[model samples]
Target chain A: MSEATEQNGKHFPEKQLWGREGFRDDPYIEAESLEVAGDAPAVILPLAAWLGLDDDVRRTSNRRIGVFVAPGESIDPLLDKLDTVPLIALQFPAFNDGRSYSKAEILKGRHGFKGELRAVGDVLVDQVVFMLRAGFDTLEVTNPVALKRLSASDLRDTPGYYQPGRGSAKTAGGFSWRRTPAA
Target chain B: MYRYDEFDHAFVAARVEQFKDQVERRLSGELTEDQFKPLRLMNGVYLQLHAYMLRVAVPYGTLSGRQMRKLGHIARTYDRGYGHFTTRQNIQYNWPALADIPKILDELAEVEMHAMQTSGNCIRNVTADHFSGVAADEVADPRPFAEILRQWSSLHPEFSYLPRKFKIAVTGAEHDRAAIQTHDIGLHLKKNEAGELGFAVYVGGGQGRTPMVAKKIRDFLPAEDLLSYTTAIVRVYNLHGRRDNKYKARIKILVHETGVEELTRQIEAEWQALKESDLKLPQGDIDAIMTYFRPPVLPERPEGWGALAAAKKADAGFAAWVDQNVTPHKNPDYGVVTISLKPIGGIPGDASAEQMELVADIAEKYSQDEIRVSHEQNLVLPHVALADLHAVYELLLADGLATANAGLITDIIACPGLDYCALANARSIPVAQRISERFGAAERQAEIGELKIKISGCINACGHHHVGHIGILGVEKKGEELYQITLGGSADEITTVGEITGRGFSSEEVVDAIEKIVDTYLGLRTSKEENFLAAYRRVGAAPFKEALYGPVSRAA
Candidate 1:
């Protein structure tokens, strides 16, 4: 990754830990995210604050986000506070919770904030593409996630079912609405 | 019923192709399951307990005979010959293979339908009063606005995602058949002295763990401002609702924290900006949309209804069914027949291919080819001639769709719960079944009178226990299944959230407790019309609580 965009800021941790070279050796990557590929090169954030992205603000969801939401709160205001962060990773908390899908969707649709949105916790293959469609641009897939297993989107005969914002860009019809206006 | 115009058809067709492509991408290994889940869900597909369940939108629960036949065809071909009608007034095929979902969606699109946003956290299928335009008490048909909401919320670019899935229900009738109080947004059509169309808006009403009746935000939101006003509310929710915790993410939590007044103020502020946008409903558009939902032409009445009524009175079985199952229609000569989806020993809302086909044929012959799946999980022949009641009942009986328990205790709202849903915390159906069996006797149920017994396996309250005159919520207490009971709840125009009496009951004891509550109501009621809710309210929950817990427990 290029160090150009890397600024001397204390927002996220800067201690990068590498797999081959332990945390004792390479100390550049501060936080590690499931979406942060490889070893010491990845970054991680508190699962809850991951709804904010870099591009546009989208902060809504259709299904459950699969996280515990305490009383006297909603998910969007927390996202509203995420003004400028580029990548936001969410925690599943539990597989049964459906609130996370709404969180991912909000990051893409409601806030319209277009940074790297990743699903880090309890993200099974079952919910991978749903996370993508709900606007998770990156999936910090864990638990020995098979790289060789057939991708769910690959099973589609026609690529462009509907245009997803965060993770996917390819489709047959190429997004019915987000097209470049037929120049 | 809103008919699909060219635009609607085009939209469905486009969505179908989009899903087809999505399916192809999944098959070709181009997308991971992680990548494919949301795409498929947006098209209303879900991988459930046993297999992939494809839910098709019935759009405010309205369907044509042809649509029913297509559902039947798909059931026969793609599923185990049956489909489940949901509390949201949609239908689900429980066993469709993942490979065939595209085919199912294709078939659905052919009949002006698609499963779009049926499952995901997007705007779900809009719901309304099953009686809708033809209810005797209605001032206006809410379906036109429901349709308008459906169109605007359909594939909306913004507000696509939030902290959780959203639900909207509208009603024009004084009787709240749509269960508007439990929805995220409930719109009640109102007409003031000026006769200007306005809506009494309720926000933050939901069924999950924290069940609260939606607070009224706007007593009179004008006609022209429906879309923009809704936009403002959704936007406010989108902007302010919680992102930290999923449980506290619904608008209800927001309203609870910021208070409804503040939420309303924020919405008003947002509306100020959007009210002038293109989102405002134009008179021409409103007029045009309302045209499609014009009441079905009624035929002059014949004189046999009186005779039929007399016969029904003499025959206890038929009388009980008629009293519970039939609803008053707008026309004096007509009555709306509610075909119960909950047949005894049969799954609630499960209709086989043959059953769908039979109902379709009956709808075409009897109800002018219009059918509405109600939020109560019953099918309604909205414009059935009163004279044709006997024939429709006979036909329904032949197909096992005629379960004479409409307002009776067996007419229950049960979520698929743990049996099918991955989100469920407990099993809802078996409890519903046990309750149905316990109250199954026609004479006994008739004696109980119109009582709504709603059970949700978990706090999601999909079973609508919160609004049930007698609401049962199943929760796990220390690894054992326990049931909590609430009383005096009503989902009508004078909606009130149910109040929990005291300690919960064990699973085996829950039904007995409910029977005790009913017994108390019967013993205390002033008259037959002093129904369960009315009786409970008149005396309060103390009597029922005393009966269920016995003397010592009541003091505790």
Candidate 2:
């Protein structure tokens, strides 16, 4: 378990949140109580808690809101409410459990969600490339070794791909054969 | 054989470097064994009972003489002097140090060969009909499509982490030699009424603890939509397949529980969205890949027929080898040569480095540098001219590769069970050896014509025991090894799972039990023309069961 650390007068887990640009401060805190809507600047809640909020409260809340979806949870309930949330975190209970990958594809490709898609748990360096391909823009990495590798920018990957993904299409439309200079 | 272009070479080389780093991290204790298991498996490295076993992919079972030579070099340098050819058309080295694997892969890469995706939950090596181009009945070669799949599924980010391992097989012939019905996705290449090439797609077929024949979802899908349609099927399975139970995780279980009609509807719906997407293959690209598999420009050998006739009349042993191990090729002057790896009383698929190099040399000299490894654990020279048959036979005879038992009783398919694999309850090779010894007589084997004996070490069915005409399953029962016999299964056009007979036989009694079954078949068949499968199908398993268990067990 990650220890809670204080920064900028806000307390959150010592999880390194990163995006394509670089490491950034994690603003959203986990909602302690869904019964009382707190006045925090930003709050992240479980799927059920997010779904339990009143429509008027959801519309009127000044705080930035996000929902974390568990492994087997369906994203159907959040489809119509995509515009109200700026971040949607998909949890990988274990690195091998890949149900969230389908969810990520559905959220980005089928539902056309423009929000920041984040991978929350068990995020490792080996899987980060796949996470990026599956439409995750942000990652909450807690593994110490993965963090060290990420900080050193030592990600290992091939120069070419045989299939297309949620990432930018590098090659002009033909057959999705994209290759970069060897890393 | 498809030569590796610059892109393909770069891809494989980068993967080699990536794995080398992963291995280094594992040795340095930066990555624990638990974290390193799947990574190593993706690169075809497995921690076996005795040592690390590396399985290298022989794409669609086709190889060049140079590639075969490279495999021999690897076996001699990094591993023991021998390598085992698996039913998936891949070769496995039973003993290779973990540190030596990177070097082995580097050697493989030099010859445009690799072990990528040979194991693991991701898509495994795509297999096809071993006699793809040379088979007389084939409409077109299936290797091109298999190559397409091999590239697309190489490191597919979305489908790499699947619920369970997936296998796909393809066949272009009317007679199904690739065992398409026993794969996760089986593609039958054919031409429709409009004379357009397409595929009849079958999904969710597998053999394991629970064996099920694949169900056809689409009668015909255009060739251009191959990748799109495949992506659709895999996506649906990856999202909705059962993950709670590892045994029930295969797509076959999903098709069973979800019902064929419903699963087909889901796959079709998913395909509808992706049919016109960027995944749709371009015709030019398909043509480009197809060019790699075009039939070799064979020289006319009109003199071969006269020369072969004279040679056959002179040598009886060469005549027997020709009769048993050769098949009709599309070219009139050529014959397809099956180099049997299963010598009498020897291990089923084990080939020594010397044998491999010898095969390479023969292929280079007589077979247009083309070699294929059959899924039934045999090597094939797909384009040997009839004129050169005697010379090839002499070369093979000197090395003990001239086994005149292609479809005979001695050509038993056995897995490296308790001897090498960590997941075995009983030994398969020794049982195979004993059975081979019992039926080593050529005349006796010829009497039991076209009998397929497949043995599996455990319930995982890697040896494909379920589809054998006489399937033998080895299991551990009450601290002793027991063998179960199944009857009447076939993997041809009309595929059927074998039926288990009553009771089991101890290791000592198993060979005798098989003898009784064979004896019963010989006694009951109307004529020698009736093969074991045809006879068993016509009369049912009653006679064999009676022969195995006697009259009293029937009443029980």
Candidate 3:
């Protein structure tokens, strides 16, 4: 059982976070097993291990299965099997490293991945709105202050958007100026 | 001019409020300096050696007379009475307290100007040809596209925190006054064989420690495909650009290390997937945006030429100013007037509040309420009638704004070096000031013709020394400031990076060395009309090197 904590004056229950028992400390390491039971808790596996799991192991698993994808790694081979995974955590190694943004967009907009797309690692307050726009449903923010700032409804009250984007609700995106005949 | 709509106004206002809150949080110790640095930088605040420097974006270098007055107001009230216009067509206030920045930004927001993305890793203020709507050679106005790109790139969620900064430039003319080749992504608006407007896209060009001119990736991308294509390119770069080494993080390095052919393939593959999305510019939307930039109404004056000619014959000083500073406009009656910010022995791009106010008044009276800031660190009144040339010149003369050397030797481009910037290795302003003084003689400058001398304090190349016809780089050698001279760089249609000519000189001797090189160029030039750059291009660095460092020995 997991406990909840208060950040930025808002309380959030901890979601089931799972990884390989032996290699959990090494954030970048691959898992060796997919041995969870049919009703096991959520599990996070490296892309290679998720792809290597036996069909029975993946199909019979009742828990949510997630995979960690890094920058420069291709997900073309995993597209066809996207239905099997419930979560795809795109890792941002650092706050300024933005490769995973494009990765998330491609996963959502191009491949039509319908699972819980979470941004993991180095997530901050300023980037949350962009993360939401880029199709991230959950953000595992590592910064406590960033988590606090997220509770302020900062993402909802953003004034307007200039670009046409998917996944997030934006106030304006089209050329309504000229269409209204300059009243 | 594109006026800010309600959405645009609301967006900037919200951004101002957001930054204000961030500053307050930093002051209250809720955020550390490391956390606050990027936040402040995204709003165009830099903590320089002296104090906080705020850079305000003059989008596409186009501003209204009222905007100019507001800039002057900011300089006078918030800053130290003067502002420095930069190489990217932005204006920087050098001395502002951190506490006063929020108020300064609020002041800027009132004028529909903000400092967003002016200093961050995101797509920077999109620059275009300064003579965009007025140039006689332009096929289409590039400002509309630049504006669209500006809106799209602003607070771009994904690309905001790229490995390094990115810059994009657009040109609508064949002559390329925008120096598109030196930008990270260069867009040249042109017409295809079917007489449809589009862009010739160039990618990977930049100047820092390792300078590379952009290479053409698409010869003719349809106008509607601009956003899709640009997004695809940035996405590919974002995913694949080097992150381990900050130096090799630019798209130029990516294009250089991973061969252009492979990079092109990757970008094309991404674009293929994104082309039909909402990112694609609909034809009607393009037309709508174009409507905003339609030329302002100004009647043609047939007698404008005769009036200008008569005025020229009456005054030689005004005649010299007219001959050097005025450029032909698409409307025959009007002319583009460049107000040189580089006064003799003065700072390169600094203008006092009084000077800015006077310029604004002049622009309002004669130039149809429009002004443009050039990347050359000069200001342009882009739509002055030929009949008002003398009147404008007289007004400029009164305020010490009328410098006859527009593209000539005295009009140098220099960045604020050790005096202001924290990253500078040596001073650059003093070196530029000395060079300007050496070439200050009007007749001598006129004889020398069109020559550009650019100086930089460090390898960051803020002054664009890498592309100057005569480039001067300041390096610190054993605690002494030495100037290294590079010969034969040009940022015109045919772009070339300059090559260094032997060892550097002491700050005391560098001016003398430059004079000797100029003397050599004057002596060896084929004709008086053949400028220093033309002569250097024809004869190469050998003669210039020999003139500076004596004859090289073959007995090595």
Best by lDDT: 2
User: Among the candidates, what TM-score does chain A have in each?
Assistant: 0.47, 0.83, 0.72
Among these predictions, the greatest TM-score belongs to 2
Model 1, runs deviating above 4 Å: A1-183, B27-29, B306-316, B554-556
RMSD of each: 9.2, 3.2, 4.5
Q: Which lDDT tens digits does candidate 3 get at residues A89-135?
A: 78776678888888888888888899878777667777777877777
DockQ of each: 0.05, 0.41, 0.45
The residue-by-residue lDDT of candidate 3 on B165-230, one tens digit each, is 999999999999899999889999999999998999999999989999999999999999999999
Candidate 2, position B284, lDDT: 75
Scored against the true structure, residue B536 in model 1 reaches a CA lDDT of 81
Candidate 1 CAPRI level: incorrect
On residues B218-278, what C-alpha lDDT tens digit does candidate 2 reach at each position?
8899999999899889988888888899999999999999999999998889889888887
Cα lDDT of candidate 2 equals 0.88
Worst 10 residues of 1 chain B by lDDT: B154-163
